[model samples]
Target: LAKTTQPISMDSYEGQEVNITCSHNNIATNDYITWYQQFPSQGPRFIIQGYKTKVTNEVASLFIPADRKSSTLSLPRVSLSDTAVYYCLVGDALANQAGTALIFGKGTTLSVSS
Candidate 1:
């Protein structure tokens, strides 16, 4: 697994668009960028994932540059309920061969206010 770099914390208001960037300078060719959100005392949930281009879902969008060294998770019209710890993970797509356990780095704490 590759290490990621992201902001320690962020502040936003309701109905605002939030973009959190994660950098993985040593990303491997077989690795994919995945984003997860974790609330207090809860497990992390998958948000979005991408390899080289843009991947969008109902909840958010993932943008990956050509170099694949970094990625950004974009959340639209976020509300107070959206506040959580966002993690950017890099790993292989194959579940069994990926690893024994999922490892996460210090995530970005997003605080959405009114």
Candidate 2:
């Protein structure tokens, strides 16, 4: 597991694009970058995941550089309803070591307003 560093908060208006970047300088080669979004009183939802290069889905896009030391999550045309806390996680699923659980850090809060 590698530690992630992200902003504490961010502000955006409706229909705006928001990009939240996370840094994992000590990331291992086996680790993959995963992003999750959580709204108030709800469990975190998986947004996207990637190893290297770009990966996009209906909800968001993940961009990882060649070094794989960092990743950026892009949310296009966000709306007020898109406001939530975003988490960036790194782990190796194949490791299968004991006590291997998803470790969560203080996520970046995105505030989408009108």
Candidate 3:
């Protein structure tokens, strides 16, 4: 398993941008970071992946440095409803059709307010 680290919590206001950073010190070269958002009593929803320099989706944008040791999840214009627990999981990016093992961190709780 990879050694991952993240903040315990974060605070943001409505319509503001929020960025959560995760660090994976033992990440492999082929490993990519996948961000997930989980609301209370809900399952995790995929945000984006940082396989290369960056990856973006409708939900969020992920940025990865060249060393692939860490990733940042950026959420633009967040609202109160956007408050949730975010997770970063690292896994093999080349294992397209194979079952890959993911290394999960504790998670970061994001609090959004109006």
lDDT of 2: 0.94
**Lowest summed lDDT over 10 consecutive residues: which window, candidate 3?**
96-105
**Which pairs of residues collide in candidate 2?**
none
Stretches of candidate 3 off by over 4 Å are 93-98, 101-103
Residue range 46-100, candidate 2, lDDT tens digits? 8899999999999999999999999999999999989999999999966876756
Residue 104 lDDT, candidate 1, scale 0-100:
92
Which one wins on lDDT?
A: 2
**What CA root-mean-square deviation does each model show from the true structure?**
1.5, 1.4, 1.7
Q: Which window of 10 residues has the lowest lDDT sum in candidate 1?
A: 93-102
Which segments of candidate 2 are over 4 A away from where they belong?
Answer: 97-100
Task: Give TM per candidate.
Answer: 0.93, 0.95, 0.89
Give the C-alpha miss distance for residue 61 in model 3, angstroms: 0.7
Which candidate achieves the best TM-score against the true structure? 2
Q: What lDDT tens digits, residue by residue, belong to model 3 across residues 1-114?
A: 567788989999999999999998898777778888889999888778767798888888888888888889999999999999999888776776776655557799999988
Clashes of 3: 0
Best-to-worst TM-score order = 2, 1, 3
CA shift at 30, candidate 2, in angstroms?
0.2
Query: lDDT at 16 for candidate 3?
Result: 96
